[model samples]
Target: MVSKVNDLDYFVAASEQEALILELNLIKRHHPRYNVRLKDDKTFPYLKIDLNEDWPRVHITRRLEEDGGRYFGPFASAKSVRQTLKLIKGIFPFRSCSKPITGTDTRACLDYDIGHCLAPCIGAVSQKEYAEVIKRVILFLEGKQERVVQQLKSKMNRAAEALDFERAVRLRDQIQAVEQVVEGQRIATTVKGEQDVIAFAGDKDQACVQVFFIRSGKLIGRESFLLQGTR
Candidate 1:
């Protein structure tokens, strides 16, 4: 049970459903003592790809809003999210900024110089090219490793044919990173149509609820929730 606080805040929603969602996101972020808790005493991290912006950037956040951006995760832990993000940045040169892209700058940022970003903001890379990188990242997060690898291989071949050996080498590295990062995640359920499948596992002290989204006979993504209460 949570102890009484000296101050409190209230939120207003137009409907009960909206109110419920607001409460859930709040509790998920705060993890109040009276609410379900996660391991490490921290909230899960969400992989937020802000699609609403002209130049999208992948951000890790705990809050979910009504914005048009796409989100993934409620991962097992924040650490896992960080690891996944490191792997993503290693392979995909997606921008990590929230600012609007303007190509007026004379020079690209350090991220572009180091090859962490494709520098769409500074006109070093076209929107179409940057979008292709983001697409590979989205595929990676969606657990479509084989598809991403094939796409990268095709892109590499095209770059090589164009005599862009540098770009071809980068694509080859991205393909290798995809293969190395995406490991064996076995299917836990029987064959079924498109659905959101959930499974739970834990002992008396804690519990974990893992939800797997499957479509077209493939696991698209997964979200995990941890509970501290006993059975």
Candidate 2:
């Protein structure tokens, strides 16, 4: 490999994270013969929320497209992505149906009956109201639980002030759920802020890398990647 290479060039990055980004971007863009294995994105899935639709639904998608949709992750596996989706659904309980949203449907689906959806099909929630839910989902997925909690609290207070005790109670339940998850993830860490912990293992011809994304001393996500050209 060294004999085949004619020249070498490099760029300096401002930080270690920036350097890693540059390396991955270059590998993805150029698809170097030796590092081609690392460029494969099919090994993981991302959480996509297509903003193009009137009622955006959260789902797992392998491809990351630039279609104005908000994407959350390249999770380690489908199972992990599904687990996260389940948690989000339990808390937010937005609409998960595929039917066109005309807001004139006669009946709600089973998901709405089971408390898994807001049932926007029958005008259970207006678009503006549903957008608020999506905003919280995005914040929660971005590891901004504190912001979500604050927003929930504010909404709950407003609901209470409006004499809507039922809605306020539901918001209270959501707040407790979010707090429980956050508390369960709390642990000791030597690092002070957001940090990415990376580990590598390899043989002569191939290698694997594991990365843990930590925020506020909690592990937010994990991923592993395989690479070639170690020979």
Candidate 3:
């Protein structure tokens, strides 16, 4: 039998058979949502990339299925996720179109004209070469920071050797951006790698607390919250 006492629910069974009977009846009658089954409807947003396909594309989604693609993120903020994706699309330009890049008579989007996308939508980059660039992005997102930094350094060196100062400068800037992300991650986490801290205080009528963000051994920011009673 299950009963409520002091706002808490308690269940008691005298014997195994009785427990089984109680459980079966609970499942059949009350059918309490939590006791019936687990829900799979909610999920956090993630960035999905089809790296193995002929013409890869990056998409923002909330599903997790094994479709021979790569997935990243359970980012706390949609805006931050979008901004990071924009930054990546700017430098990497792996394809963002829905259609295959076959002989589609494609034209460059605004991203290309604004120097954000590499215009893979227009067949500017072949599948094999674009796959290589996507691989670099995957490595960078997978926390293989040194690998990406080394690869960018090599690219910058090659561009400099080939007397392409403009390309070399761009590569240098990309490397710096990657470094900045790593540094930011380090600063966002505590020494134990915990990202944020939360505290709360409350009474019958109201509640409030201040949250402090300690980044890289420094208190960087804080926020306070207040809650109201309904009745």
Candidate 4:
């Protein structure tokens, strides 16, 4: 391969990290023959919260932009990301719709009818209240579910005390759901702290790497990367 080369090209960067980034970009663009290649390499999905909006909405995105909103997870798979979104939507009544929030919609959308949304579009929920919900969602995504559960428990107690039985019931259900998810997480490590467990497998032509993200001993998330050019 080296003997066949007619000429050489080079690039320089200000820092090692910058150089690595440039190298990755070049490899992605040109798919160099000798470079180890990722099979089906694509940008992983992220949960984006655009706070710039009048009512920030949490949804999935593949691109990371400088839109001044919080982004979470270059998660393993689209299916897992969507499942996480569904779980969050079930617990927090944030708006999933893209419709403008004028608070004047004549009718709430199906998301509202199905109890998946707070219907901010129709003024069913105040901006301040919706913001609080978004806060919990962010906390949940950050693997700070304990803090979120504490907040929910506090609110649930208050609602029950105030005789808002419906709201109290909703909060109770959310707390239970969070607890169930937490309990379902297996203890992937005995070290008693957060760490990633990585494993790799390969053949002559292909390889796969798996990562298990453990937080406080619990298996929180996992991702797999497939690679080619193993020979």
- Give the top-scoring candidate (TM-score): 2
Error of 4 at 218 (Å): 1.4
| Alpha-carbon shift of residue 156 in model 1 (angstroms) | 0.8
**Model 4: residues >4 Å from true position, as ranges?**
1-42, 186-189, 198-210, 224-231
How does each model score on TM-score? 0.65, 0.78, 0.63, 0.77
Tens digit of lDDT per residue, candidate 1, span 1-231? 235776777888996446755666677667677666432334456899877667788979877677987788666567878887887888788888766679767777788888888887778888788777778788888777789989999999999999999999988888887776554444455676677788999998999999887765566567788999858
Off by over 4 Å in 2: 9-32, 36-43, 189-191, 196-212, 223-231
> Model 4, 28-145: lDDT tens per residue?
7888778765323666688999999989999999766778999886666799889999989888889888877899989998888877788988889988888999999999888888
User: What global local distance difference test value does model 1 have?
Assistant: 0.77
Local error of candidate 3 at residue 88 (angstroms): 2.5
* Pairs clashing within candidate 3: none
lDDT order, best first, reads 2, 4, 1, 3
The lDDT of each candidate is 0.77, 0.85, 0.68, 0.84
lDDT of 3 by residue, 1-231 (tens): 245323655589995435654555556566556564413443456788886677777778866677998887654446656876886776665667776556355577776676555666667766666677788888866667668888999989999999999778877987888777666554433275334578888888888877766644444345677878822
Better of 1 and 2 by TM-score: 2
Off by over 4 Å in 3: 1-32, 35-42, 103-106, 188-231
RMSD (CA, Å), each prediction = 7.3, 4.6, 9.2, 4.9
Pitting candidate 2 against candidate 4, the one with the higher TM-score is: 2
Clash pairs, candidate 2, are none
lDDT of 2: 0.85
User: Clash pairs of candidate 4?
Assistant: none
